[model samples]
Target: MGQGLSCATTQEHGLFSAMQSGDLDTVKAMLERDPSLTHQTTAYDRQSALHIAAANGRIEILSMLLERSVNPDVVNRHKQTPLMLAAMHGKIGCLKKLIEAGANILKFDSLNRRTCLHYAAYYGHSDCLQAVLSAAQSSPVAVSWGYARFVNIRDGRGAAPLHLAARQRRPQCVRILLDNGALVCASTGGYGCPGSTPLHLAARGGSLDCTRELLAWGADRLQRDASGRIPYLVALKHKHGACAALLNPSSAEPLVWPSPLKFISELNQEAKALLERALMDANREREKNILKGTAYSLPSPSHSDTGADDNISEASDTELCCICFEHVCTIEVQDCGHQMCAQCTLALCCHNKPNPTIACLNPPVCPFCRSAIVRLVVAKVKDCDDADQDIGEIGSPKMRKARKSRNFSSEGSSSFKGLSVMSPFGKMGGRGSGRMAAENEWVDKP
Candidate 1:
């Protein structure tokens, strides 16, 4: 009884020491005597020999434990497998060995529900996270559990790997996560880091590089969290002015966003729908006024026949629109009596592209007067054809309110780039506004 007890004690002490110091020879010899010892865990936390070798980055000892008989997925008291330890320490070589040995990369700790990816991300271990993601993508069995799942996997706090990486100021990890299909604008909901996105967390962490990476990847700068705070606002909240400066767009730098084409397409659709409706209404009003014959005032009778007279030609030249210099200036900007051809006015309101700089965008301004145009008036010419001439105009009643505090580049944006800024008011707008050439009389706007 005494002799067997001594041998067991010797074996236990030798195994613990060998595992602690990464003694390859002693570990090998002990395994030779009894391979079953490979499955045993220490008294504390139930960490096995594999856990020890992995935590210590012992490639050779780790390889033997993995190859001999150690369970790669064996859980400690905390429910973290050897893979989790390897990932936390950023043991790249040991991480690769365990992955090849078929370690469960998706295992999470019982306490925090954190996956190996989360551990790698929290520590900014881009290399380890990449390996786990690569393995999962390659495995045919991982089709349902692909990179999308791993990259976005959140812990108990509802924080995804990206959120952790961003909060920790891991720029490379942020780039990797974004490149691997991580949702850039995903918010940390109520349960976890509430109302914070990766960008928000990056801002809070005050890492300019991380903030730039998020922005470059198309993160919404104006995405509001639960507290109604945008990412840029969050940066300011934490007193990260440099980060906020980058987020703040300026006229000097050209604005480019992640989905420039998409934003443009959506805005154009909205402008077309609203403008078409306004145009349709204005046309009906124009036709109604025309039927009443108050639509136009008769001009003084001119010399009949093709005029070769210099005075007649000179009279025609005075009516030519200044902007186009070819068409008549039928519409005039409110307040500022600047005039342009109705056709040019329509095109101005219907411009489709974002003005590269918000400050330089002058959709609501009269090109000639440089004054804020409130509304537009289209004067009816006695002989002008309703079907041929542009008959519709835009209203700017709401422009002052929407434009005053507008940030066109913000996530929830408001722009009337292609839509005419002039609001149509039929004949009411004709009084004292832009005048029809020659008569200088206020006329019904089309």
Candidate 2:
């Protein structure tokens, strides 16, 4: 709300309606009779006709408003100028017109402290972002806010346009910001970031494409968050195995730094232990079957939940998902060994993206250890009743029937198949260094 808004009459409600409907002729005739109508604002939000025209991308109406020299920089209650509304709504044409009219590209929304480029990037408007970038070029005199200055400007959350685009899973916008020199690794630990890089955000978001784009643009894969998690760790904690696969140290070509030696040693130890356990379980089952003559019946063995209050889950369950304590634990997180029912795990991974359109945007994290879940293994624990029929040891690979499992070859995984249970961390996220356990760290234990 600015100059001439107070004195202008609002009795002509027809002007508002006409502009809203894009009735160009009606607006033209009314404006000819009373050229001052462009300066009047709506009674409620104090949004002038220019604001409405720009917000709705009324190109013809906007051109007419600019012709009258209506102040295009005027902001409404939220301190959102017309350019901000245009950028937020993906109204590229309106944005172009505003830039042509000398609207300040540097003015930010008062509430979020976001420049117009942040709005465009957050909403995934690549073209709108380009328009804002090209604004400094079209100006009469030179402006300080060039392509370099605008793309990297942080909001109240210290989130550059790149940060906004990365979190929102706008890969194209992210690329544009980076191409224009936006800092890819800027940290925003507090606000939306929760203390991680844009790559970390990309990992949590579960967009493999976005993660790749960030990585290709020099996003650090090994950079740690406040919790000492690299992007790969973040992905693992969140059950996005596919994401972890992209950044897993085991798969990538050698890094210049060779990573912390302790991680490698722990992974080796964890793999060895898992292989031993799985081999022992397999031998026990074979011996039991041979002694019982394959069909000889043995009495079912009864067992009770051990250490029910260990204050932790150790690849074990209580006949139920630990989170809900209701349904039988049918599914086990592959690497970390958290056993929860499929219903609970699926709900957790998909809560952020239930709809198919945005499903690929979010990767699920583990409910217990916050590790990225690479795979889910489904197998029934052997009960004494298995002696009555042809049964493999409860933990044997033959007894395991994988459902939705990507890789069952690792022994470190809850689902033992061709390989042993092993992880990057020695005992599922390290031997209790003030860290929650139960994440399979050795994704690659060949």
Instruction: Give me candidate 2's TM-score against the actual structure.
Output: 0.53
lDDT of 1 by residue, 1-446 (tens): 00011113445667857766778898888989998788776665677778777877888999987777577888877888889888988988998999899888878798788888888898998999899888878865367666577678878888999998998999988878876778878888643348788888998898866875676445766677888887777777888766665554330111112222222223344333333333333333332333334322223223321232233333344454444444445565545545555544543443212333342322344554344555555532222222222312212324322322222333322222322233323112222122122111111112
Looking at model 1, residue 26 earns an lDDT score of 88
Please give the RMSD to the true structure for each candidate, in Å: 22.1, 18.6
lDDT of 2 by residue, 255-355 (tens): 11111122212334333233223222322332233335323333332321223225333332234344444444555665776565443443332111012
> What do the candidate models score in CA lDDT, each in turn?
0.60, 0.59
lDDT of 1 at 62: 91
Which ranges of candidate 2 are over 4 A from the true structure?
Answer: 1-12, 137-147, 253-446
